[model samples]
Target: MKFLHSADWQLGKPFGRFDPDVRGALTEARFDAIDALGRAAAEHGAQHVIVAGDIFDTEGPEDRTIVQAISRMDRHACSWWLLPGNHDFARNGGLWDRVRQRAGDKIAILSEPEPRELEEQIWLLPAPLIHRHNLEDPTTLFEAMETPGARLRIGIAHGSIRDFGSSGETKNQIAPDRARLSNLDYLALGDWHGTLKVDARTWYSGTPETDRFQRDEPGGALVVEVHPDIAPTVTPIRTGRFQWLNRDWTVNDKAAFDAECDELLAKVDAPNTLLQLSLAGITSLGDRVAMLARLENDLGHRLRHLAVRPDDLVGRPREEDLAALSVEGMLGTAATKLNAKIDAGGPDGVIAKRALERLFVEYSREEQA
Candidate 1:
């Protein structure tokens, strides 16, 4: 049987960290990826699409958000199974019921621990979450669930796979060998936003849309093909519109840093890129100021979002830099005192760094005027 395994849609995420325009684009991309996923299912001739968990960013999503999601899922034109996740847990609210009302027969909610016979020779055992955070493993029941001897048993769940050291593994841990213990043909998991293969029979499809820049491969779905007594063939298909990047660089000189920045810009398509940069090592205070000016003026306008970690970026002012400022007398005495504080490292050293940068800025602006 040919099926599509995807999860962690996280639809309706607010993207509050970005500005209004960027936030809209990011939230819209998640919905856009749903259509892309549908197109992938059609291309692969998938009979079923199983979204392991976290269909929505939260249970309290706006009604319009829920309606739009259902409409997108309906466009797939295949049987789509959505299991409840921590974010959209099976609560007392009418969120699931509202979805059922709009979804009709094309979308099915696997909100139980029952073995559903999806096809004549295929069965699906889903362990849907009832609460956001459960101390017990949600897949524990899958180990004892029974299916017909001739059917291909598939387990669907949303949690961390054990021994993986995932950030939330300790809270919602699932045995890494659950597939072997449960005698299943394949196990599809979620919660970790990265494409991973835990074992021959277990895999995570990751989020269809990239959310963070944690260095793991995201933004894809797994097209799985299972036979009665053979291992499933899993193929990852990319379906994200935006590119997320986290880059780290160490700069010893201004020229090298500028070249690296130019190369990064050349490689990424700015309109669809979100980049986070971590800079380390030392540079002259003048060069540091120039680099930041470029980031705020030239580079910031090119990308959707740009974040820089400058804590490790130490600024060492050269004698020429201080001399160029040309504030002799009382102001010069202040500069001399600040420079001394910088030489002797302390809280005063940090203040001196900021004070010197402001002085440089003031002098530079005056020169330009």
Candidate 2:
């Protein structure tokens, strides 16, 4: 059986931190990504599609967001097994209830702990989030289920796998041992936003499209193909429309800063990326402002968002430069301290720390006038 495994769609999300126009664009991009997923499932001839969890960012999604999601799923005309993660828990009056009402008979929402038979040979063991948080292992119930005499025993759930070293106040934690004990051929998981493999048989498909700045792993979905007696082959498929690039560039000289900015700009396809640029190391105040202005002017239109870090520009400050300035008191002290820190050979500690210092110095100068 061929199936598309995906999770954490986070539909109807508001990028409030971004500019109004850019935020609107990001919201639209999410729907576009979902449309792409549905098309891919149809093209691949998938018998069913499994969404581990987090179908929506909130319980009350906009009417348009909800309509678009249902329309896309209907387009596939195949079984859609959707399990609720922490984001979309199946509480009374929750988004799941509304979706179930709208979805009618086509969408199968697993709101309880039970095994659903998709076909004679295929069975889906669904473990859903009943409450906001379930500290105990939710998969324990399935561990005792006598392996159904089916061609495939697939486990679908949304939680953290304990043995994988995931630490937090996580609810509905699924231990690695449970997956092995359940005797299922494939365990499809979600909650973790990065694609991870717990064992040969268990996998976290991650979010189809990412909403954060984490660059730990490539964000995408998984396509799993299973045969009756053979091991399932899972392939990671990239489905994100926008690229989130986090880069650290050290500026030891004017030429180096300019070159690094050029290199960082090259990675962006412009008007298609969400970029966070962190500049570290030491540079002169004049060079720092110039770099920030240049980046803002040249790449602002091309990027969905841009964040500049200028704290590391204080390496080996020329004290004579500050002495020559008409400014005095706190402003001069801040400049001197910033230079000392940058000269202390801790380029990797915190890029934002230096950026903050530079901000204070700039603000102090303006206030004193």
The candidate that wins on TM-score is 1
The 0-to-1 C-alpha lDDT of every candidate, in the order given, reads 0.84, 0.74
What TM-score should be assigned to candidate 2? 0.83
Q: Estimate each model's TM-score.
A: 0.94, 0.83
Error of 1 at 295 (Å): 0.5
Point out where model 1 deviates above 4 Å.
Answer: 163-166, 216-218
Best by lDDT: 1
Instruction: Compose the digit string of candidate 1's lDDT tens values, residues 1-369.
Output: 999999999999998899999999999999998898899989999978899989999888898899899898888778889998988887655468778778878899998788888888688999988888788888889877778754799999998876556444225678889998888899999887778999878999988999887653439999999887788999999988788899888886688789988998888778888889888878888788788788889888999989999767777767877677545556566677788998898898988878977776777778789
Q: Indicate the worst ten consecutive residues by lDDT in candidate 1.
A: 162-171
Q: Candidate 2: give the clashing pairs.
A: 134-172, 271-302, 283-313, 311-354, 311-355
Segments in model 2 whose C-alpha atoms lie over 4 Å from true places: 144-148, 163-169, 216-218, 315-369
Q: Write the per-residue lDDT of candidate 2 for residues 1-369, one digit (tens) a residue.
A: 888888888888898988898788878777777666777787788778898988888777888888888887777667788888787788877787788778856689988778888878688888888766887777888876554677788998888776334332146778776556877888999887778888877888877776777763435888899876677898888877777777778776678977876776676666767778777776655566567777878776667788877555553334555663426576566556655564554663345345544655576467679
